[model samples]
Target: MQRTFKSKIGILTHILLLITIILLFYSMWIKSIVFLVIMLIINVLFVPSFIHTEYIFNNNMLYIKSGYLPVIKIKLDTISEIISHPKKNSLFTTNPTKRYALSSDQIILYCKDNRRIAISPYDKEGFIRETIKCNPDIKISE
Candidate 1:
């Protein structure tokens, strides 16, 4: 069985994004309807791509895949730790800032070489339990 975890943009966040897009389109200083339209289109297109993610554990390895640009996969044995913590900034951005992964659900996976991957699981507790069951040696912090 393939387990999937989808990260959803909160309703409030989506509303805020729409309002921002409208305001940007209406603003005379940066009056570029085309730009605003393009942004809106991109945002709408991007949401669905992130709505479904899959994590497969098989043959002593774990695979994490998303329906977004630049797919990713991680091996289970290489994972050093799994931490449940709030991130400060959006994961899509390169800037380092504090942002919550999910308002109420977040996890940070640290790899063996110090690489970190953050995810906002839909069912945080269940995911944790399942992860632990798969890799008992992996550390988990609540």
Candidate 2:
């Protein structure tokens, strides 16, 4: 069984996208080559990425995808624990984690090798349920 989950786009990202587009049009109207180039780069590289981020679960593997970036693949069985609503920038937490989430609230997947990956799916509960269905032995932290 294969399932696809879209990442939750945060308000900040939407605001940034709006600003970028406004500036892009403004730059074009004024014929400013420098601003146009900068806006184009941001629009091409950053905006699409946040808007199109998604996670795919298929055949015991989870694939994380964003615009233009390479896909991240993880084995479902390798996940050891899942942390919901992790505290951000806590001084006590020194553990390094890779984040693919666009929102502030995220789910963290801890793998067998101590690798941590953060993600934010639109349906957090459903994502957890599906993940548990795939890997029953995985631990969950509220």
Candidate 3:
């Protein structure tokens, strides 16, 4: 069975992003209509990921998707541990690991090969449970 968990995005975050985009387009329009239109088109194309980011657990794989960003696939067997971070902080950090998170409340999946990826799912507990089902030996840390 395949399970999908939506990303946890706050209302304040959405409002801020929307306002920023609108302000940017408005400034662009004041300078050049063509540039404004092009930016608008690009933003429209990339907006879906912001509104509907999700994580999918299908069989032995975990898929992380955000906007027009490339999908990240992690095999269940390769995940060695899961660490949950339920705090408020900057979403885009200078951390070396790949992050598919919109909010600070996220889980870091530590893989056997030493690769780490962070993701934020709405149902943190359920996501962990589903992952454990696929790879029973995976460890969990708070």
Compare the candidates by TM-score and give the number of the best one: 2
User: Which consecutive 10 residues in model 3 have the weakest lDDT in total?
Assistant: 86-95
Q: What residue runs in model 3 are displaced by over 4 Å at the alpha carbon? A: 28-31, 34-38, 86-97
Q: Write the residue-wise lDDT of candidate 1 on 1-142 in tens digits.
A: 5565555456665676666656656653587878777666765765444444555555656566555545566667777788776444534442222222333355777779767776666677777777777678888765
Model 3: per-residue Cα lDDT over 55-93, one tens digit each: 998878988888877888989999998887633453344
- Which ten residues in a row are the worst by lDDT in model 2? 89-98
Q: Select the stronger candidate by TM-score from 1 and 2.
A: 2
Best by the lDDT measure: 2
Which pairs clash inside model 3? 49-67
Candidate no. 3 TM-score: 0.79
Q: TM-scores of all models?
A: 0.65, 0.90, 0.79
Candidate numbers sorted by TM-score from highest down: 2, 3, 1
TM-score of 2: 0.90
lDDT of 1 at 70: 50
